[model samples]
Target: MEISGYIALAVMGITLGLVGAGGSILTIPILVYLLQVPITLATSYSLVVVGSTAFIGLLRYRDHILFRKAILFLIPSALGVFAARRFIVPTLSNILGHLLLGQVLVILLIIFMGIAGYFMIKRPILDIQNHSHKKQNIKKSKVVLIGLALGIIMGLLGAGGGFLIIPTLVLLMHFAMREAVATSLFIIAINSFIGFVTNQSQFIASDWGNLKKYLTPSLLGMLIGLYIVKFINGEILKKSFGYFIWVVGIAILTKEFIL
Candidate 1:
C-alpha cells in the first residue's frame, strides 16, 4: 500500500473518533483507488475496516448505547445486509451488461459520499427536544423499514451508514446526541460485520496481510482522535471534514465516470 493509503486510514480512524459516525465512509475508495484492491473485494474489506473500527470507537461511549434499541434495529438490518450481499450484489453482477458491478458500486458509493458530505457540512440540528417523551413511542414498523433500508445501503456500498444512522437515531428515535452517536457505532459495527460475514467467499479470499496494513494506522488514529476530541471544536472539525469528503467525492466522480 502507498503511504497515502496509510495516512488516509489513520485520518479515517481519527474522523470516527472525532465524530463517531462518518470516518468509515472513506474505507472503500481508499482500498480501491489507493491500495489497489479490487472493488468487489474492497467492499468486503470495508466491512472489516469499518466494523472493527466502529466496534473499537464505541467503547468510549458504551454507557450511552441502548442495547435494546440496537438489538431491535439489528434484526431487520442484519437480514437486509445478508440479503444484499448474499443475493443482490451477485444478482447485479451477473445481470448488469456493459457496466461492471464494481463500477456500479463505485457510482453508488460516490452518491452516498455526496450525501454524507452534505450532512457533515450542513450539520443541521433538528429540534426534537420537545418530542423527547414521544421518542419511545415511535412506531416499530418505521424502525424496521428504516433499519432495512439502511442495511441495504450499508451492504451495497460498504459504508457504515453513520451519516444516516446518527440522524435517524436523533430525529426519529429522539435519542440524545451522545446516545445517537454511540448507538450509531454499535449499529454500524453489527451491520458492517453482518455484511462482512455474509460474503464468506470474500472473507476467505481477502488479502489479510494487505488489510492489516490499513487497519493498524486507522486504529492508532482512532486513539489519537479520542484524545484530540477534548481539545478541538467538533463543529468546525466536522464542517472541515465535510468539505473534504465533497472534494474526494468529486475526484471519485471524475475518475470513475468522466476521466
Candidate 2:
C-alpha cells in the first residue's frame, strides 16, 4: 500500500509538471486512501508534497513566469489560505464529529474534483488571439476574488487549486497558455507553502522522514514531465487527464458510499 502511494505521488507530480495543474488534486486522496493516513494529517502531508514539487516545477518554468501577475494574484490568495488553515479548519474540525468532518471533507474534495475535471475537459473558447482586446477587458477586481476563492479551496483541501488558476490567468490576465501555466505554478507553490507554514499544529505533527520518502519519486517524475512537456500538446494532455480524474473520482465515491 505504501509503495502504491509513492507511485501515485510520482504520477501526481508528473501531471503537475506537464500542465502546471491537477497534480495537487491527487495528493490528499492518495495519502488518505492509499497510505491510510488520517484525513487531517493527510492534508498537511499534501501541502508539503504539493508545495515542494510545485516549487521545483516553477524553477523549470521561471523564464515564462510573469512576476507582476503572480504577485497580484498571490497576495489575497495567500491571506485566504493562511486564514483558512489557521482559523477555519481548526474551528470546523472541533465543531464537527470526527466521522462527519471526514465525510464533509471527502464530499467537498470530490465536488471540487468534478469541477476541475469539467474545466479540463471543456476548454473555454475565447478570442485569445485578440490580445489587446482581452487585456482591455481584464477586471482586476475579479482577479482578486478568484485568487481569494482559490486560496480558500487550497487551504481547506490541501490541493494547489491550479485547475482554477490557469483559467483565471488565461481568461482574465490575457496570458498565453504557457505563461498562464508557468505563473500558476508560482502561485501554487507560494500559497501552498504559506498555508502549510502558518498552520503550525499540522506542520509540527507531520513526519518529515515519511514525507521525504513519498517526495523522492514525485520529484523525479516531475523532472521527467518537464522534459516531455516540450513535445506534447497541453490541451490534449489536459483533456485526457480530465477524463482520468472523473474516473478516479467516481471510484472514490463508490468506495466511500457503496463499499
Candidate 3:
C-alpha cells in the first residue's frame, strides 16, 4: 500500500528471480519483521505468493522444462503431499497452535536448508555423459522413497523444496543442472499448490484481506526476478542465498524465542 511496501515487494521479486527457491524464505521474514505480520499469517501469505510466482515462472519457461521427467517425479510427490497434508499436518496443527507451530516449522526449515546448502557447495563434479550409468544403478524404490520424503517436507514447511529437490535430482538421479532446476520448479509448484490448498481454510478464515494486498506486488517482483534469471549465473549465487536464509532463520528463531 505504501512506498516501503512496494520496495519490499520488489526486493522479494528480485530475490526469487535471482534464486528460484529462496523467495518465500525472504518473503516470510519481510512480512514478519518488516511488515509486522504474525508468523501464522505470514506463512500462509508466503505460500500463496510464492506458489503464484512459481507458477508464472514455470509457464514462462515451460518449453525449457522436461515434462516427462517431471511427471515421473510429480506423481509420487503429489501422493506424498496428500499424505502429509491430510494426515501429518492436521495432526501436528491440532497439537500445536498455529503461531508456535510456525516457529517450530521455521527451525526445521533452517536445518533442512543448511543440509541442502552443504551438499550444494560440496558435491563432486560429474561428467554428464556418464549420468546414464549412474541412473541405471539407482533403484526405482529409492527414488520413490526420496520423493516421498521431499514431498512431506515441502508440504509441512511451505517450501518448494528446490533446495532439496535439485540436489537429489542431480546427484541421486543423475540429471544435469539445467534439467534439475527445471524439474525442481515443477515439483515445487505441485507440492506448494497442494500445501496451500491443505491450509486454505484456515487462511481464508483469518487474514484473507491482508493477503490480497500482497498478491500484486509479489507477482510484479516475481516477473522481474524471472527475467533476471535469463542473465544470471544461478550456481554462483546459491551459496550467498543460502547464507541469507541462514541469517533470516536465526533472526526469526531469536525473535520467537525472546520477545
Candidate 4:
C-alpha cells in the first residue's frame, strides 16, 4: 500500500505539470497519509515539491508567457504569499477548537477540489470573438485583489489556486485553457517561492525525512504528463480532468471526514 501510494504520486506530478495547481492538492495527502509524514511539515514540503515541479512546467510552457498580464497578477500575490507564510502559518496552533489543524486543512482542500472540479467540467461560457474588449474591461485593481486572495490560499493551504486564476485568464484575459494553465504555472511559481522564502529558516531546520523519495518520482511524472498533454485536444481533456478532480475530491472527503 505504501509503495502504491508513492507510485500514485506520478499522477500528482503530471497533474501539476499539466495544470500548475493540482500537484500540491494531491501532495499533502500522499505525504501525510501514505508516508506517515506529519501534517504541518507536509504542508511545507508540498510547497517545495510542487514549486520545484511547477517551475519546470513553467519553463516548458515559457513561450506561452504573457508578461504584460502575468505581472498584473504576480506582484500583489507575491506580497500576500510572503505575509501569510511569514506570519500566519507560523503562529497557527496544532488545533483549531476541538479539531486538528490538519483535519481543517483537509476539509478545506475537499471544498476547493469540489469547486475546482466544476471549473474543469464546465464549458467556456465567454466568447473569444470580442475578447479584446473583455480583456480591457478586466481592471488591474480587481486582478490585484484576486491575486492577493489566491496567494493567501496558497500560503495557508499549500495548494496552487490555479482553478481561481485560470477562469480569469480565459474569461477576462481571453486565454485558451492551455495558455491559462501555463500562465498559472508562472503564478504558482512566483507565489510558492515567496512563501518558501518566508519560511526558509524553519524549512532548513525541519526533518524532511526521505522527502526525495517523493520528489524524484513526482518530477519525472510531470515531464511525462507534459508530453502527453500536447497530443490531447482541449475541451475533451478539460472535461475529463474535471471528472478526475471530482473523483479525487470525493475520495479525499471520504478518507478524511468519513473513513
Please list all clashing residue pairs in model 3, or write none if there are none. Answer: 13-221, 17-225
The local distance difference test score of each candidate is: 0.83, 0.84, 0.69, 0.74
After superposing candidate 4, which stretches have Cα over 4 Å from the reference? 19-23, 94-99, 125-136, 176-178, 204-209
Off by over 4 Å in 3: 1-6, 119-136
Residue-level lDDT of model 3, residues 1-259, one tens digit each, is 3557657867766766666665555666667667777655665576677777777767765666777766666778777876777787668778997767777776776677566556445433355335545646677677788888877776665556666666667766777766776677777777778777876777654477776777778778878887777688776776677666667667766776766
Best by lDDT: 2
How high is each candidate's TM-score? 0.92, 0.93, 0.82, 0.86
Compose the digit string of candidate 1's lDDT tens values, residues 171-201.
6677788998899988888888788778756
lDDT, candidate 2, equals 0.84
16-47, model 2: which lDDT tens digit per residue?
A: 88878887788888999998988877777788
Arranged by TM-score with the best first, the candidates are 2, 1, 4, 3
lDDT of 3 at 215: 73
Residue 99, model 2: lDDT of 73
Choose 2 or 4, whichever is better by lDDT: 2
In model 2, how large is the Cα lDDT of residue 83?
84
The pairs that clash in candidate 4 are: none
Better of 1 and 4 by TM-score: 1
Tell me the tens digit of each residue's lDDT in model 4 across 156-223: 77777777777777666677666787898888877877777778677542355565677788888889
Is candidate 1 or 3 superior in TM-score?
A: 1
